[model samples]
Target: MQFHHHGYVSSDPRVEPAAGVGVNRPDELPDEIDVLIVGTGPAGIVTAAQLSQFPNVTTRIVERRPGRLAIGQADGIQARSVETFQAFGFAERIIAEAYRITEMAFWKPDPNDSSKIVRAARTADDPTGISEFPHLIVNQARVLDYFAEFMANSPTRMRPDYGYVFRGLEIGDGEYPVTVTLEHTAGPNEGATRTVRAKYVVGADGAHSRVRDSIGCTPYGDKANHAWGVMDVLANTDFPDIRTKCAIQSGSGGSILLIPREGGYLFRMYVDLGVVPENDNGSIRKTSIDDIIKQANEILHPYTLDVKNVAWHSVYEVGHRVTDRFDDVPTDEIGSRTPRVFITGDACHTHSAKAGQGMNVSMQDGFNIGWKLGHVLEGRAPESLLATYSAERQVIAQNLIDFDREWSTMMAKRPEEFDSPSELEDFYVKTAEFPAGFMTQYQPSMIIGAANHQNLATGFPVGKRFKSAPAVRVCDANPVQLGHHHRADGRWRVYVFAPDANAAVNNAAIDASTLDDFASWLTTSPESPVVRHTPEGADVDSIIDVKVIYQHDHTRVDLGTVPAIFLPKVGPFALTDHEKVYATDPEVDIFAERGIDRRGAVVVVRPDQYVADVLPLSATAELSAFFAQNLLPQNASARV
Candidate 1:
């Protein structure tokens, strides 16, 4: 029989096997909960699911909504967010539900005649030639539901409950145990509120976060005066294939964003409230859409604007601001002690919808905080680690604001007149100056955290680093069936780099080697997995690229300090300048003599495929110690 785990059980088990979580009465409250996650959006649910992965943790998510958020809240799944979904074993579901749009169309009105002209076209054509999972268009609810499923199936036996509202919170106690007051939305006992004591509380509630308000935390940033009316229309229209477009329709204040969804177009109409300021805060009303669309038609002359069926509609006021810090500070601050009650997504920062970053940014906010919370809950790290969340995510929030600001500026600039690269350079300079380098890793959340044994300065918690690695099909030429690497368990890996030894040594454990013994080790080592380069052997590229390391470049490094083990032909490598000895010298005469890519170095790869440490082949003891300290130990000494 198949044994499936954590999920909500509704009355109809077949249809809602794990959909609704029964409410926990006030009397039934546990003595202590590992975490109290506020909000049910992308960030809250993802954090709860991640926290529930640890066996000892009991996480409870309190969402005020009576049911799942139904609407076109956030639509696009950025490449990085998709990878994080892969880690949670939900990427497939997202991909299945999403509509794949590879191309984007941006049209601007001809200022002279009011006729539309193609401004720029964007495509996911593998420009970087590295990403495996490109962007996708999935509704925000589906992603949240995946997170809900993940939490329900977690080893911690905790699932998110909808229709539960948080009434109040108290965080002054030394142990950080929070008393969360919650009540169900429906039923006889619906309005009743009960107090729940939790070890930690995460305020993932949106922009106007109740948790933030209760915690006395006020948002800091420049609020936008204009509010945009974004409507998601479900209709078969003329521009079915228009994935994204910055159309400057006639009579416009700000440009409109036309995002073609599955049988729909997510339109963002820039409602001009007059020249208040950039990213100033305001509100949007439904009546404003008709005017906005009218302007859109007038500005964008070529495409006939037709209002079909409106599936979902909402207005959001954009802002450009970030919380000063994420942790505790002087008592004078508004929410100083409430730093433990962290916020993400719209709660922390807000930006214009131009860069198509609303959903992408929200998922990333969750990605940034989830793993760090997990680490802290496991007791594997100190409370100081949690401080990094605000530090890291705040910068990302700032960058998003900056990116949106610049994008708007670029859109405002006349494309035809710009001759010099000055505009691009200015944009790059602004981006480069942004504090959070974490934005790049946000979408693909796959880079592994550096191990303490590797580098102390860069030893971010494992979750942050792990979120950056790519999940791809590690292809092989052989026709035999094989299992792909799974991220479900969240386990890290250590790849031993030595000249191919006998297949016996290819076992899970990495064995260090000496440079001088390299040639002899490959030919004579009973456990060596490395095979000598012969005309009869398998293709060298396939062996190393596909089978051994899987799809990703799982940490290539010089095996050791042994000078003899250094790569035969290398001045430098990407991650480090360390040398790498070839497994078997290639057959190519020039390469055999001049050396080849660093193929022999062994690396300790974190579960997220981040390089933890590079062990020189010469020192087995040192390598063993490094692994023993960082990875889950087979023996009691390393076990935490």
Candidate 2:
């Protein structure tokens, strides 16, 4: 939201002034580029959007389809994806158009009449309140549209090159190591083939990814024996919970997972099609729409459905699969060889859609690799940094495969199989965090530091997404979520929590001597990451932004008393940035809520908003060492 520094902006600030590669961008594909992303799905678009933030990094995304996706199969938007949308600056707009899932209704066979199903329990969608953002049900296509829009508005003005199908790719020893072969699917150059070289290539092409095959990576896991018929329809149903999210289990008929869609009259139903016989040869996929509706009515028992229109429908079998690694680097050659080709989303992992994790997890896959690729391509980090993408995300993909397999199995179970009637509901309540996308916790790596000083800020767990808390902006005295301030702009964050204020005097401010000393060390010390990593002549806060949060109330804090590091001069006019200073809201103390030590603490957050490390204010050396492992010094020559 900061603007007008370069010049007075009479137009919308979201539409960044085009520069670099974005200025008069060519319509035809470039012969050489810094990065080439394949596919325009959820994962592909997110990767492009994140890469678009780095104007100097030339990034291009291609799609086989002629244009944007009309209707996406995935519709469930987890809270974690919504939080990511907040960082991308479109959460509010998307939420307004999305259906908020408040509660989930479970139905079981009634004792009085075993044939009929009755409401068993109604549980809150997020009973544990893992995130302030709502669990949404928005079409996957719409979500991609938002990301595509963000890319277009960015300084790079990126847009997907439609009708360009990825043929294959090969890694070489040259500067632009990845030579990608592509075929034009449409336009005057239709049926023509071309080759483009890239420094790094990302494959988001999907389950049958050509890029994955070229890299010698294969997805290995169990194929589903259970089949389900899914349909998005506008219907009139006598079922009481038709408009609500319901998990219905009938005495005779199969179970049904009814999820309300965005529009008031439209909803999606996953009608159980029973177990597929061995050697059936995918015959279950032929289940007709009429058959799906009939099965849905049978599951409802006394109630019936009169379908008016079928929006979209499909038949899919539940399966769990994951690749060994997400990059071209072989297991044994990881450290010695840097990866030039990468894969994400369905290319790396595949799972059931019933858990609503296919698109959500895929988006995270894009985010994980996108930043790493940007850092290396921009010369901000060493080539060794690219190796961590596979090391970190491969484990997360495996974890997701396991969680979805269990959830899908539970959904396919019959009513009699459960030991207790509440087993299904109990499982849903117990494993809420995993489905909501909050269970991911990356292990210690070069990028993620060890939790040696976890006690300093217990609420901000290392390697997990930074949980947002309310605090007051000192300049404007406006309440804001600390985590929401983070944007997907490819800059690391250093949150310096000041010590508690003295209670002896009314409205007494925190002691500034400690903050001053720390600030001096950060700006002047040669070992400081900010001083070592930042390129010559660049803004002080360009690579790593430092902000301060005082323990005193906003009214008691004096802006002039704060250190200059928290208010660095930047932009063409060199205007002082005041947004970095914040104070604990009187009503809601952020320090207490987030368990920050009353004495003092420093939390280092990754560009993706995960808590990388927590240290005391005095641990400047430890902080320097942590970043030294990840970032390359500005003067050092990049391997790429």
Candidate 3:
């Protein structure tokens, strides 16, 4: 809930890092910039924002739109996305303008009397309490504005080339192999086309993506006879759940979903179009706005909706689809690797908007690639890390397609259309995990494949995001949620869960020598990646952010009672300049609550806060190897 207060930058200018920052910028912007983004939507903006941190990596975005959108296309903000947004430093501003979904009402006619409406079921928005942030509804336009603001303030200063049109993309032999052709929408450069090149290209363009077709990432999925109408309106409704989320299944008419939006009397309504008329090619014709509202009125037979004003409305044929390829380095005539060209967001996948997943998953796709692309360009990681973007994200895209197919179908069909009456409700409850965003897990990839990963002490599985727990800061009594610090910065977090200061080791009990074994392993492994990369007198914080987490009774013991590793010396050869320490609250043991033991653990948390891998203190090999796989060595990083 905490917000970082920063002054707004005046005018559009290249955002340079602070004076004498950690690393020097490249002397010149290379002919082939680090990355070229093809759209200014959620995915493109996220890519720009993340790469902003590493100024050495030059990035640019081109959008065909002439101006920023006054209205957005999506509304649902999943918990997982909110947490990631918190890390990016803008969730609070977004939350201030959003309606957090707490619970839902499933309205159907009473079983005994089919004429009277009744609430058949009510459940918590997140029934499992899986995430800290609940499902929220807000104009995706606001989300995009925030992202655009971040771009303006970014060190890269690649404010979108809005009003610019992308003509074509060609990747051939050259330093900046991916060539993007573009033209200005207006101004002195009107009617003139130019070419921009980059080491990597991202196509965040919409489903009718020119990039998808240019790259041959064909969209393949089912598009049934179902059609839907969505609208944001200001109206008067007598339905009891007017201000709240309601799934109304009328006795005679089709289903209508009503959700109250951000300000005033604004609300969103989803009306089932049943079956639309087919076109000459047998494709369904797009429904008209008037027909959509007519159906909405029909669905709410008992309670009337008197529309005072209409904000935006759209009607479309329902369908699910995903591209086969996300990224590729095509072979030359002799079968050599070409430059990197990739596609994300709608360019890669599209599905029914009923789930409110388009914008959330799109931003996440950008989040996943942002850091990996930064690492590759900065020489902190090899090109192999870039491959995980497609590997990790494509699965989520496919899963979303499958989920949308069922959820949209169930919501569109009448109760009698199902084989059995209860089938509709059963399917809704079963696939609840899709929208939560927590269930999306990346399979084993070069970044995640680790040794002895399954035998970790804490049962928090690798590939799953690290779950958060409440605890108080040791320095101050302020309460801190662990996930709050799972920042989007490129650095990885190594949480070394140490024993209580008063707890026992092999030969000693209730003493300061509690972490003798772990400390020895750390200091002795000087040739390890951490020590090897760190300057002779530098702290390891430059390499990775380290924190020691435990559940010790602070009242019973002082800071000196704990091992020195928990309280590392700051001068030189220290883990961090600022003490990297944390502990559980006296009223609750956060570690034990998460099935962690007093013996402690070494949990490797990825930049995205996924529990990447865990190891025993004794297994220095596993720890070293894990870092080596994900991060570039000292000499390799110097190439930046």
Candidate 4:
């Protein structure tokens, strides 16, 4: 949102002035590039968008499709994804257009009338309030559109190269190690082949990924022997909970997961097709739309659906599969060699969509690899950093598969199978966090630090996404969420929470000597990560952004007494950025809400907004060591 630094913009500020590779970008595929991303799904698009921020890095994404997807199979948008949209600068717009799920109604067979379904229980979408964002239901295509727009407006002006199919790829020894073969799926040179080389290649291609095959990685898991027909339709239904998200189970007609879509009239139904027989030979996929409708009506029993139009539909059997690894480097060669190729999204993990995690988890996969690739390619971090992508995300994908397996099995269960009528609803409420995308907690590794200092900021748990809380900006007196200030710019964040103080009693000034000393050490000390990692001639905060949040109210905080680290000067002109400093809102104490120690704490957040580490104000040395584990010193030569 910050503008006027480059120049006065009469047009929309969101549309960044093109620079670097963005200027007069070539239409044809380049012979060489820093990174090559395959597929334009959620994973691929997000990776491209993140790479677009690093204008100096040559990155491109290719899709086999002739153009953008018209309709996407996925629609559920978890809260974590909404938070990511905020970082990419489009959460509000997407949320406004999305169908927010406030409450989910569960239905079961009525005891008096076993043939009819009755509402069992209605629970809030995010009963635990894990995130500020809402659980949304939006078309996957629209989400891709928003990300595509962000890419176009980025400094790199990235755009997906449609009609280019990833035929295959190989990793060799050299600077551009990944040699990729692509086919022209459309256009005058339809049958022609193109060869390109890249330092790294990412496979966001779906289940049948050619890139995954080339890397010798296979999705390993079994099917649930259950089939479901899903469809987005415009229909009139006598079912009272049709417009509401409902999980329906009839006495004998099977079950239905009815989700209301955006635009009011459109809704989606995942009609259970009953269990497939052993060695069915995929025959259940041949179930017709009419058959699906009949099954849906059967589930509803007394109620019925009069379909007017079908937007999109598909038949998928429940399956849970994940690869042992997500990268080209085999398990035996892990630390000895660096990864040159990677797989993400459905390429590495495939599972039932009942929990609506395929797209959400895939997007996170893109983000995980995107930043690591950017850093390593830009010489900000060592090539070893790339290994963490697979290390971290592979575990998360397995967890998703397990969660989806349980949820899918429960959905397919008969009424008599459940010991209690409320069992399904109880499971739904109990495991709400997983579906909301807040259950991921990265274990300690090169990127994620140990949680020894977690007590300093108990709320911002190490390895989890930084839970945002409201705070008032000191300069403007406007209340803001601290975590919302983070963007997908690939820079680290250091939030310094100063000791408690009563600003009014202290005459508009709280003792900040401790904060000033820490800020001076961070900016001037050679051992400081900020001073050690930032490139010469770059802004002080170009690598690590430092911000302070005081317990005192905005009016009582003295702006002049603040440290210079929080007020960095940057852009074409050395203009001081005063928006970094913040104070606790009088209405809500962020420190208490987020469990920050009253004595003070320093929370280090990764570019993706996950809390990397928490430290006491005096543990500046420990802070330096944490970043040193990942980032290369500015004086070090580029890894190429």
Candidate-wise lDDT, in order: 0.49, 0.89, 0.71, 0.90
Q: Which ten residues in a row have the lowest lDDT in candidate 2?
A: 503-512
Evaluate residue 67 in candidate 2 and report its C-alpha lDDT on the 0 to 100 scale: 94
lDDT of candidate 4 over 1-640, digit per residue (tens): 7888766889999988888888888877799999999999999999999999987898999999999999999999999999999999999999999999999999899989989988889998887788899999999999999999999999888999999999988788888988999999999999899899999899999999999999999789999999999999999888898789999999995999999999888999999999899978989999999999998998898898999999988999998999989999899999999999999999999998889999999999988888888898888999889889999999999999899989999999998999897899999999999999998999998888898989878999999999999999998998998889999999999999997654322255445466777888887888888888988777788888889998877888888988788888877787788889999988889988999877788999999888899998888888989999999999521110
The TM-score that candidate 2 achieves is 0.97
- Regions of model 4 farther than 4 Å from truth: 501-512, 635-640
**Residues 136-200, model 2: lDDT tens digits:** 99888999999999999998999999999999887887889889999999989999999999999
| Cand. 3 Cα-lDDT | 0.71
- Tell how far residue 179 is off in model 1, in angstroms: 2.1
lDDT of 4: 0.90
Q: Stretches of candidate 3 above 4 Å error? A: 1-32, 110-117, 277-286, 329-339, 418-426, 450-459, 501-524, 534-539, 560-579, 635-640
1 or 4, greater by TM-score: 4
Q: Per-residue error at 91 for model 1, in Å?
A: 1.9
Q: How many clashes (backbone N, Cα, C below 3 Å) per candidate?
A: 44, 0, 1, 0
Q: Judged by lDDT relative to the true structure, which candidate is superior, 2 or 3?
A: 2
- Quote each prediction's TM-score: 0.68, 0.97, 0.88, 0.97
Q: Could you tell me how far off, in angstroms, the CA of residue 392 lies in candidate 3 after the best superposition?
A: 1.5
In model 1, the runs with Cα more than 4 Å from the true position are 1-31, 118-126, 174-176, 235-254, 263-287, 328-339, 412-490, 499-599, 602-640
Ranking by lDDT: 4, 2, 3, 1
lDDT of 3 by residue, 1-640 (tens): 2111123346333333332221443433234576888888888888877776675677777777777878887888888888877887788889888888887778776667555566777756777677767788888888888777765555655466666777788887666778878777766778888877878888888888887777767788878767768899988878778878878787764887777798747999988777765652534345667777787887776667888888998877777899876876432221244328788899889998888888888988998888888888877787777777877888899998988887887787665577976665566556666787877767766667453645544556678787887776676655677668766667777777776555655655643343566665555455455554543444445456667776664454356654454455443232222235677877667776676655677787777677777776566777787777777666422100
Model 4 TM-score (2 dp): 0.97
Across 106-204, the per-residue lDDT of candidate 1 in tens digits comes to 454455654454454333323442334656766777777777766665555566566777778876675656777888786567888777787778877
